[model samples]
Target: MNKSMNVFVIIALVMLSGCFPSNDLEKKQVHLTGITMGTVAYNIKYIEQPIDGGTPIPSDVVVHQNVERILKQLNQDMSNWIPDSELSKFNSHDSLSPVKISEGLRRVIAESIRLGHLSEGKLDVTIGPLINLWGFGPEARPEKAPTQEEIAQAQARTGIDNLMLEGNMLTKRIPNLYVDLSTIAKGYAVDLVAEYLDSISAHNYLVEIGGELRAKGFKHTGELWSVAIEKPVSTERAVHQIIIPKDNAIATSGDYRKYFEENGQRYSHIIDPDTGKPINHKLVSVTVIHPSSMTADGLSTAMMLMGPEKAYAFAEEHKIAAYLISKSENGFIEQFTVEFMPYLK
Candidate 1:
């Protein structure tokens, strides 16, 4: 796992759960892969389940269009890069009054708030100011670390408490509040697509966006969906582990590949909203499995920010299945909650 998986999920070469089907469904399998969500690409493999009694699956073109439609709407609603996106417009709004928002945006923001509290504000969606200050956002990178006063000013502009939601409306106590769903939006989008496949009677499927992924049913061969966990190394791509999701969602967050090294110190793109600075911890990556991709997404990010010891404790306390990799004097160390032992190969 790397920052690409956390930031946008740009790992396209590794097919974590892209499996083949049995002889019966071999020719019926429909696989779709393409770029979306600004930079990352999505890979989906599914077989349309029988409809009514024995009705055949719709043409591949129809399924393609349907999935594309869903993703396009998500980008329109949550993309911070799009000037006219729902999230961007919300950020541009200077009024304190509640603004009417789409149901989808409201749901995503609502989940983000819950996670913000769960991680003690470490998994903030309204952290655009601080992200920009550290040269990770739309702003250009600064030559040196931000001054203490500058960090304080950015901190003042952020906080999960600053945002409020009522019904289908959203409100920002401070007008300049900006929201970026980079941490979890891809997973949310993956979930939405999975829901669509379910609606169309897809009996078996694997949905992956960037590196956030979810799988369901079997491969038409009686095997559960298997995915690869990446080794936390920047020089090359290698599998750290292979595990079956057992009809669940999985998300991994790390920064081995996307960070700056200066004066013998490394700076991760993942910001600690509380500190208003990049995380400097030894923990390198976090992998979480959950029923909901959105939850797994947020949990992975939050755990990464917590470092190793605290993350392991939190995962155990919450009974979450988590795998953590951290830097060591010699090389790296591995630890996972007991719940994760079941998924190990």
Candidate 2:
């Protein structure tokens, strides 16, 4: 497969069991699946049961419609590809003054800035220019690696320090700074869907967008939600580990896919903001489990950029539940933080 197709295959590694309940007393399962945010697929499963034992459970049509509406609104607010999206408008704005933004955009930008600080600018949203120059953003892919001068030009337009968020407004320190939230937006969408499910009394549900996911309560069989982490291999897909992420969100970032090889060297899409180039490290994948899918998503990317050793230290220091997989001469090496041990099945 080509590099782009390889990315889709690897991302499909997070498998879920769609088994339905057989017993009568067991809550009925409602599954909703659809495409959203470009090529990403979303799957939402929840138990259909009356909370008060009197009101009838919402029909499948109602739930599906509501979920789609929620996703559509989120995409409108955050999608950089959409010419009319709020983010796109902000990017096009040349003013250095603070520009008013919606509450949703404000929250996303604030969280991104916080993560940038936490990761010491490793997970920067302002690196869109570099990403585009490297043929990973909305721009068309280049036939070869970018030259040093081109990379330096893109790097000049990026820096976490160029972004500022205050209340419901965002300001750019420099007019040329471009921001992209593709790394964390999907995770935030998952969390938003989970919150919507909870608000509708859906205590037992699994929310997954792309490969990022959040699970709460239990399945119809009274068992916790099971998630599988994909083994990082280009030739074939396989499960590396299975875990019961009860009432938690899980996200994984890997470099085994979405990469191109030239002159016997590989260039991954996951760029290191420090060097303005693709990460060159033994670490293949990093998974994080947290209370918020948004946090897990951002942390996973940051940890992957740190590589195996630093990622392990960061996870331990911050008390983050994380799993790191690295490429080894013989095969692959697997490592998990102490906090992640409880979830392993």
TM-score of each: 0.90, 0.92
- Rate residue 269 of model 1 by lDDT: 89
Q: Which pairs in model 1 have colliding backbones? A: 16-227
Q: Give the per-residue lDDT digits (tens) of candidate 1, residues 1-345.
A: 111122222333333334444445343567898889778889888866553345566777898898999999999999877889998899988999999999889889889999888888779998899888888876788898789899999888888899999888899999888888889898899899989888777857889999999998766444567887787888777767677777899999998877877688777889998788888888888999998999899999999999888888889989999998888776667788888888876
Highest TM-score model number: 2
Tens-digit per-residue lDDT, 38-97, candidate 2: 888999999888455545657889989989998898999989788899899899888999
- Decoy 2 TM-score against native: 0.92
Global local distance difference test of model 1: 0.83
Find the 10 residues in a row with the least total lDDT in model 2: 1-10
- Please state every model's RMSD to the true fold in angstroms: 4.6, 4.9
